[model samples]
Target: MTTTFDRGLALLGAILDAELGSAGYPGNAQLAARIGLDQATVSRMLKDLAALGLIERAERVPGWRVGPGYFALAAAAGDSRLLVRARPLLRGLVARWHEPAWLSVRSEGTALTVEAQLSHWSSYVAAAPGARTPIWCTGPGRALLLDHTEQQLAELLEGVEFIGGGPRAARGIPALAAYNSADRLAGVVVADREFEHDVVDFSAPVRDPSGAIVAALSLAVPRFRLADRTAGIAASVAEAAGALEVGAL
Candidate 1:
């Protein structure tokens, strides 16, 4: 018993899932052919999708892909559960390190902050939820990269624009590989003024019971205090991540 409404929903779901798997946006003609719909119908549906925030045009190109609306809905559902378990731990990290603590998850090819607890200090890094950062330039980004395979990393790096915020920022795949290697060995990653010269970030992976990395827990501190506190900060972040994992289990 399939109604027109059900069929329409199915078409929309197919479009979203197909776009998710695509490395680049497929034009209306391509999508219409794939979905077995007429070009005009697909165009109309795409308009509706765009208006609903389920799809968006690429900023630098003439194509459509998953939009913030989809990510926002996914994040709201997933992050609410994650925050329920990670919030107290993030608060603990902020108290222990006297720095802002953040929880970020993979959003397409970028890192999206889902939760953050600001430090009490007057001068501190500001990371609001939904803030998106490059996957090659931040501690949590690098930490998240540790889960990617070489082929996946290569694919993700293709067409990526390197926006170096400082001398320490990773500008290419080689540098990102080095960072990932170090993070894998140490079980945590540190980015010192990579995204912003005045900020230092220490992050560790938050794993689910099945051992997949679900998010990254990070401590954001001022660069002036990073020299002597790097090790301590890393340890604190790691401990918080461990607690998150335990709570998830």
Candidate 2:
């Protein structure tokens, strides 16, 4: 009862998993060997995947890897769920704190905003959905790192350029490690004027039902408004994030 389409889809999935496991792009023969398919069949299926934008060939090298279309599909499916579930919660944060709130998830080593509730305040930092900020420089980014291992941290920081934004912006791995340690212990992170000198970001991790970190919920406000209320703001964000996890279940 196996249809040709089903078999083709299975092959595509196998090829994609193989490519994901490889360090670099794989050639058709390499993929065929990995997936136990003949070279000619693998080549034909690769062409089909390329046409569907599920896989792409390297421009400068004779190899293949997963393509942007795969990521787009993933984001649409997964991020949309998170956004929908977090919308009311983000709105609540804005309503309660009178500050902009954001929901972000890690994508390609950056914190990609998927949802935002802008503050009614005249002077506010506006962040549109799909805006990307470096993981090394944002509160949500550091909060996302709480689950990363030391080796993962090194890999993430490798070759990343550090730009100064505030007095507390971490300049090197040692400082970043220190920040991560403290944030992990506290279950939240506060970046005071880290991205913008006038902006203070408070963030807490959003975990899935299985206790894996899935995203971060954060609030951004003018530094002047955040004076002496860091703990309270962090607690609110953490409470909202916990509500999101419960809703997910």
Candidate 3:
């Protein structure tokens, strides 16, 4: 099972491990050249490992250290979510927007909000921490599919209910555009259409140490506030998200 692809990856990982021991984990550009890879390839591999839970890191570092998830895969196991590390950052986002910020993870075609807090006076999502959202048509669901291929997106959305509203459960491609205006996963946004909620959302993709966007940070607000503070709150939230994204590394 260890193909050439894996070997190339192993070399890259070794380079990082070594650098961390010496240079304190330099940027990807330096690591790539040391490992005989170009910068972009190093970035791609880092994202791959981040998605697989082998490592996690922030964007500012330009490199990965390690993900808390690694402990789960080791012979001696610990928590799987790595939530403890994410809480402080997620909580700060709530304070930034004064609205409920949802913390979620995807599993078996469903997006589960594991943490919920309201920054505003009222609770919008109303979905508790354990709330499960179908991959069909929700902000978090669409956010997860932002960079995926058509088939990959479909595979993830199948059999899920489109409770959040849009075209339909099967036609979730719009969900991607609903988040990523640029049509790529570098960054994304979310707004409600055809639902009673009438909310607008903005989000940033959270990458693990390897540099892959695994989870996402999202904020929800009434459609009115969406336009009102589009520049102010949204920008601040994005900045904070950027901070968190980089901190994860």
Candidate number achieving the greatest TM-score relative to the actual structure: 1
Tens-digit lDDT string for candidate 1 (1-249): 145445456555665766678545677887777767788977887887676556778777676777785676476556566788778888888788777888887776777777788777623443656566777888888888887766677788898867756678988777778778877888998888888777888889999899999888998888877778888888989988988888888
How well is each residue in 1-249 modelled by candidate 3, as lDDT tens digits?
Answer: 157466545644664576558766556677676777677877877776566455566456655665533433331113233455556666776777677676555655655555556565444562344445554456565566566776676576555444445442334455454445452434554445422256655555556778666665666777766656765655655565566567666
**lDDT values for all models:** 0.76, 0.76, 0.56
Clash total of candidate 3: 15
lDDT (10s digit) by residue, model 2, range 1-249: 166455456665765776667546778777677667788987887887676456788778678777654674467456566778889999898888888898877777877666788777623452545556778778888888878776788888898767765667888777788888888878888887777777888889998889998888999878778778778889999999989888877
Query: Once model 1 is optimally superposed onto the true structure by TM-score, how far is the C-alpha of residue 119 displaced, in angstroms?
Result: 2.2
lDDT of 3: 0.56
Decreasing TM-score order of the candidates: 1, 2, 3
Q: What is the lDDT of residue 127 in candidate 2?
A: 52
User: lDDT (0-100) at residue 112 of candidate 2?
Assistant: 67
Indicate the residue-level lDDT of 187 in model 2: 86
TM-score per candidate, chains pooled: 0.69, 0.68, 0.56
Model 1 CA lDDT for position 187:
90
Q: Which residue pairs come into collision in candidate 1?
A: none
